[model samples]
Target: MNDHITTPITPDLLRGALELERTEHGLAPHRLPVRARAQGDGQLAMAEAQPSGVRVVFRTRAGVVELDTLRTRVGYRGMPLRPDGVYDLLVDGELVAQASTTGGKVLLLDMATGTAETRPGPVGTVRFDGLADRVKDVEIWLPHTEITELVALRTDAPVEAVPAGERRVWLHHGSSISHGSNAASPSTTWAALAAARGGVDLVNLGFGGSAMLDPFTARAMRDTPADLISVKIGINLVNADVMRLRAFGPAVHGFLDTIRDGHPTTPLLVVSPILCPIHEDTPGPGAVDMEDGSMRFRATGDPAERAAGKLTLTVIRTELARIVAQRSVDDPNLTYLDGLDLYGDADHADLPLPDRLHPDAATHRRIAERFAEAVFSPEGAFAPQPVTA
Candidate 1:
């Protein structure tokens, strides 16, 4: 019985050892070549690799300027204005692009088109044109008096890979409210807040004025990876009147069915629209003036159309809950959440939506607090249930 055995080293054991070593001594460093630059008259200029391709540059002067390239628009709230100034973009420290403005507002840039425009106004597209394939390195320069913040910068880098572990991803889709509308900061958006509270990673697909149950958006949600998901629908549909009741139900089912293709057993929650009296039981599209007490109601359809239960917010909320209820019998992991539960009649009375449509910063914080308690807490509603026979 004098036999000897040898243990084979497995990949997992090797990886564990490597990780332990890294944690103890830190990562090995690589030497970077250094370069010298010309210095003159108390000024020092350094030479670094010029970043290739078109990139946005942001600087400050007297007033404030913000650049947002994302789907959502930027808001300056209100800031003091300075004299006329030219905001310029330089390539290799040479002037190549510019936006002329009177200062004190949000500015938008479209690097793809090399165009710049002001916002809380018209939407514009920017194209880089003939320099698309040949351009590298970009810089932004503002006059010596304005203050600025770079909200977003376009990038072409490949997305980083997910870390190895039992990952849980939360996918949320909604309208402008979820798109950080009127929120004080990007990190303060309700979706971002909820994600932080719930301790889960998120892929926010909120699109302002673009969550109208489009087939493409549905397909995108269907294909995206998720461990848990929720869709805050209805308000945008009601405001837009994109479809009638007859079509709305089927669209909702289709949307859910598409998502189920990828996340069959994942926990899914369907939410209704929060209370907005303007569209509660009203029909068609309308706009209200916040400055004055003026209302513009469109006669897109007759009163009977509303009576027949078209795309009213109330009707959609009721039907969405019903659909999810019925579906839950077969798919136990599915659930329904009344959006008003986050900011019900009581909360609304205190923190009313500023524009009579979207919630302001204070209201957003309130909703995030309630949502964390209700859905994200350990003993909250979304907690996993015990398996049954």
Candidate 2:
């Protein structure tokens, strides 16, 4: 007789998502809650649904596990089809296996016209067998760059949700770089790697082109329960050319103020953008360089615009340092980290950004190492505080 058990995907078995949307095929994890999604654009929609740090967590003695999923893959019309998203399986906190689905829905975009088309496909199954039979922790990390709908999970033995034992929860918000851009897999993203090193549960809200200090996003961050919080700012603002320097400061202030409304004493760190040579002194309205039929980015805004309060990486960094310094006077838990400290000129020279924008896989690992050492170490900003009488 067959003894396999099939389990339905539920919130109890999932981590990192603020909300889950029920879909025809299965449940879709979302980094942002419904209210925040309602206020966002298409970019935010795609990014949030990618499930950067989201994963399925459970404990079981089964050696055989099967997961059914429907993945939504993104593609560009002229560019070669992107590779299928990767799903990583970790047993007892160690990466055990990696797999990719064969076919699923595909969303093709026309970059020049800003139009997109979606083609339907069927669900795919990812199976992992030959794991040790002893009871162990299991984490099935979803694809960080694809929209995944969880269908069902099958195991040779019963599975139970893992309890949130002693791990501190880390809530991070930023741009695409933090959204696992160019990272090898879900567990390899800089934020994920850093969270692993810190021994914290991660919640990543790194929208691709939509980290524009949206009020609703700040409110979402305010309402979320977290032991540690961080916001990586500057890049998206500059690339999108959404605001001037005059507006950027107040927007950042308001974002932090909103988060403080809920967790006034939580260790909150604000990080500026990492080094981007093209946008260092040049203002953005960054443009795609498609003349050679390859993806590259160049800043289009005039460097002279800085005199008119236009935002650049250098200017933003200075302003962020000033704001954090002034605010740290009243809020001791508030800390500022220069993005360059994570990925700076010297490091960039060694590992240049693949597209003059996002970091490649190796750079992601480097950034994660720097972040873990600087922010997760005992002396770091988010380090555990000693209790006093």
Candidate 3:
């Protein structure tokens, strides 16, 4: 006879064990958190999931709420949460959902009623349903004033996965115009529309009131991953009057250099500002009239200053082209696209920008179409290499 020994399991030993296991027989959904800028407000919708046979346990600063059955056919929208504190969700006590609203917006969900709301002030809560199993805890993350938390979460189930293969990634950075400023939907943003037209993934780094040649943003772009990249500059800088020509040249160089550090020979495109009559040749103390959509210009620099061929859009665009040409001599993959190429005098003449500034939705579509044609067409400006067997 052989003696058998049995090992005893203790709660402490299993306490650290990951108990949540997603299997074909059961379901566990992934949850995403929303983030909003300080004094900024917005909403976030959840990624559609297998609504049938799932339950959601949502947690917010307000408290925890359990949602009933979710509708599989229709995608669910999340409740609104403000940027008061960290927000999070847990399934079986394993942290699977998290988000922060430092200075931006955060959206949570309540699937039962199919209603979504934005959180007021700096903190809020939301809940969802269709969790296949039990949940243990929820969590939230609030880092700082500069972070905007917007996330898309889903429960694990039999959902169609994004096709895998050689995927095309579009990396873009620009000013508020590219940041979905007045666009009706996120997908309607010119950059987003362009990405869809080209069938490429997008990494949008468009920042409102913050595209003033920050080295940190350049560093961020340099470190990020992408198959194609473009930077929309000049408009914000000109409007802000943050730098003169003396500083602008070096800044452009530095910004591109930073991105080149990582992208190296990637298809990088630099874009100048669109046509703005007020700021085209005139120096700004730019003012916007919401009532009449007319812009009033205050002279920030002497007309003689610009008369010397400095601090004008023409000068900036020329300098940008020069720098890119010089750099492209060594890095053939780099390129530059004039903003006017997308929405020049003719296009603008027809679809004049509503406020004498930002393009309206129709103009956005035109710009998107032009960009797609230029960047994605077979003979487009930034076409991919022909694959060789």
Candidate 4:
């Protein structure tokens, strides 16, 4: 009935990815490779496939564009409902329109009962009509919060993959804060914002609740192509209450060592946890304080635990600074960034973290602005080098 050229989506059109695997219905873009997926923790395996900053990019003169996606959505049975993920369409690098699929698949979990269920949905399509006839670069940003599979791509005019240009690739990994916990959309995530401001291509490894310096993560970073890299550590360490002081230092060292094996001279920045007042001096296994329907985080570990080598933000910062200082003696490219520089007490007074853990949208913007200024400045660690002919 209709006569539009429908093109099959393939890896060539995708950006900010390390590997792409063909799925039964579509293509699954992964931040980590198959080998890394097989060896990493279940959380890492799940998080790496979410396509945080990944997008489908191409150059075209199409007057209309349509995208078909198979999204796997997540829902909490008894908790607050998660909003539908957003897809950003950028025309020549500027946001033009936003889209989200209606239905594909849903994974529901009954948090109170510890039961979970999966429901199959349908493929949904988003179309943007009346594009200018001139050739322009188009990017369809995938939802950072959803696990999406690319089904197909259609355009009225022919499309071609755009070869990467001068922009450097930024590979970053961290906790929920880095994962865009409360960020509104994929492109608006702090990492993406910082990348935009810094004029770099982002490969965000900011996996929610899975930034625990796993060797698999480090190896994945090692293998991925990146010009600059950063690892934000500590919050997950403190909140997950996973390691003791005895193991924390070695774990940090081992994680860095694995990355160094692959990126011996790449600009590698080690960032300590941001200012979290509750866990400033206190230890944690953060717990939820469900008051009415609102959920807030509370540090459950004791302050005295620090004396026993339990990790805290203050303690972690001191150790991370020490590690970078010592390593920089031999590896000049290594650098350290105090996470507080991104979000600290003074700024928190003005823009407080709404949930006592994750920053709200406004805070995310502020942090991204600060990150861009601080890390991309001329003297900054990841500053862009002037390109030469």
Candidate 5:
């Protein structure tokens, strides 16, 4: 192997991705393309395009692989520092190394003042030294929770993009629950875990604080190539109180319609949100209460609001079941898995959502396991097809 060889970080070397757009630093992998981005709020756009489940896949005989990246870290004033995002390295499909950037810019926020500031930090390089001497496939999974810009790549040997996974691509979209919120690592996100067990390539479009049934997101899904698809809806909508029930059904139909436009026969799974005690019956617009010097979420909407078409997790589940059942009459590929099946009140009673909303890492594991068993079984709607020799 050569002592040094710099490879431009280009789009061709990545997989489980939708689009790669040039950022000021280098390439920013995006789940949503320009068209979808142009139509979303700055928050939604940023979250949706943050490269969850995106990774760089290449083949080489390199002994050392170094990746330079600029990560934008989020911080809250007076709170415990958030850990650096992890970059997982897999060789021949087995995880061999895990890394994190040493330094990057930080976005600081003061929840009390409603003010935010940026602290400039330097770009950092992550090096994974010592690999097998023979040529092999390598995949560097980017940090799922950080906003990262791929600046450059260096290896000891010549490299080329590896072939895409032989397994079908599974495209899934949801809110923070699916975005790896509080996940142990990018590859440990529930969807990631399920994808691994289900033996499918994952394209995670789980946008934290987003996933509001946006037309652009649906359109993006409609245009993307995929063999199987799923959308985990409800949590973000209810928490954000983005829409009333009167508008939700039509919005859902519209979103599914857009996906059907392109994936006329692809098996589509519509997942409702996992059980959150706070939002189970209480209509949302969830509020973060820091009045007691603790950051905890509280259900702000009154249960009475449901009388006027407001949304709650229970309401969403019922509606989603109805919608999927009605459509399955003609579209047999459509399936609905009650989010409760993956996680319900009983599970939560034992697991307990630490934040009263998002699932902890252990809970993420439970959800992933349930999802794999329920959806990837031979009788399941998204059962894996046997590979032909």
Candidate 6:
């Protein structure tokens, strides 16, 4: 008989989630708080529930660990089924094992109709054994693309919460790219990788298809305690085509103002969208192109719409730069980073986006490396400030 001790899943053992909801089976970690979720639409609800950056973290001497979870995975009605969500186990901050559980629920989506169907399934377990019998920090990075509910956690030895170290808390909000769209695993996402390199605790708010500048989201960020903050804007706004240029500028300002209300001196970085060819000069209401059973996306709005205040990648970038410059007069901690510097036309030629929408796994790593160099290095904007008396 396998002897293991069952430990209740508690908030202290979780990282990167804004709130935890008590579910019938166990607990579901939500990236957005309850208030924000209530105001968000179905897209935001699904994105936040995906747990892009959430993890189960603790310290243990156990040689074997098992986690029972109920995961809700997304799928398209006609597109090829996505691969099972991956669970990455890290021992002492190094990826030690990667596992996945089967038989969880599936939410099949209809791309053209914007509707979805849920198929219920039973809970499954992910097990990782053969760890060296020594005390070490362990983190199980939940699948970034799945809605995972923690049912139970078991280990051969006792587990305890890891001490809060001196690492800075990085709270970032952005679009699906920041939400680990095509990243292989949770820990590999560009934001997650950048957080690891920066030696910071990541609180990711990169909701897929849901990075709209909502007031509630800003309030949540304002209330959340963090040493560093960043918001990647433009892409989602352009693709969704929800707001025009007339409304975009004020929305950006309002978003930053709200964040400053709570974190007046914290370093804030405003990043524009990366190089997206179709949406660079053209407006959007981006549409799906299911060509030959392969999924692709394209900007469908007319380019001339720019004359009427329609937003585009290029327009958004110029506005964001101007906004940051205007705000920096009094907010010295505010900074702007052009997304093209992270991924530009040159990059597209070398590492084209697989879906023409989201970056591939390798690109995610590349973005993370670039971001670390630009924001976390000694000379970077987010580098530690000097003390003065």
For candidate 6, write residues 1-389 as lDDT tens digits: 08899999999999999999999999999988899999989999999999988999999999999999999989999777789999999998899899999888999998778899999999999999999999999999999999999999999999999876557899999999999999999999999999998888999999999889999999999999999999999888999999999999999999999999999999999999999998999999998888888879999999999999999999999999999999999999999999999999999999999889999999999999999999998888889656679
Candidate 1 lands at a TM-score of 0.58
Q: Superposing all C-alpha atoms, what RMSD in Å does each candidate have to the true structure?
A: 18.7, 1.5, 14.2, 1.6, 1.8, 1.4
TM-score list, all predictions: 0.58, 0.97, 0.61, 0.96, 0.95, 0.98
Candidate 5 stretches with Cα past 4 Å from truth are 112-115, 291-294, 387-389
Clashes of 4: 0
Candidate 2 local Cα displacement, residue 6, angstroms: 0.6
* lDDT, candidate 5, at 355: 77
Tens-digit lDDT track of model 1 for 155-267: 23211112333335677777767755566543456775676577565556565555676565566667666777888898778776778888999999998888888789888
**Pairing residues by index, what is the TM-score of model 2?**
0.97
Residue lDDT tens for model 5, 1-389: 25789899877798766887787888888888888888888677658656789998899999999999988887779886578889999998888999888888887878788777878878899889889999898989998877788899999899998767577899999998899988888888899989989988899999999989999999999999999999999998999999998899999999999999999999999999889999999988998876444467889999998999999999999999999999999998999999999999789889998778888999999999999999999988798787689
Stretches of candidate 6 off by over 4 Å are 385-389
lDDT of 2 by residue, 359-387 (tens): 99999999999999999888999885566
Ten consecutive residues with minimal summed lDDT in candidate 4?
Answer: 40-49
Model 6 / residue 179 / CA error / Å: 0.3
Number of the top-ranking candidate, with lDDT as the measure: 6
- In the range 1-389, model 4's lDDT, one tens digit per residue, is 15678786767788878888888888888887788788867456657778889999999999888888888776777666578889998898888889777888887766687676879988988778777889999999998877888888888788998887558999999987887888988888899999999989898888887888888889989888789999999998898899988898889899999999988999999988888898899898988787777778989999988889999999999999998999899999999999899899898899887888999888889889988898999989988798789
Q: Rate the local accuracy (lDDT) of all candidates.
A: 0.53, 0.93, 0.54, 0.86, 0.88, 0.93
Clashes of each: 14, 0, 45, 0, 0, 0
Off by over 4 Å in 2: 291-293, 385-389
- For residues 243-314, what per-residue lDDT tens digits would candidate 3 score against the true structure? 788888899889989999998878888888777776777765455442433333333545566755447666
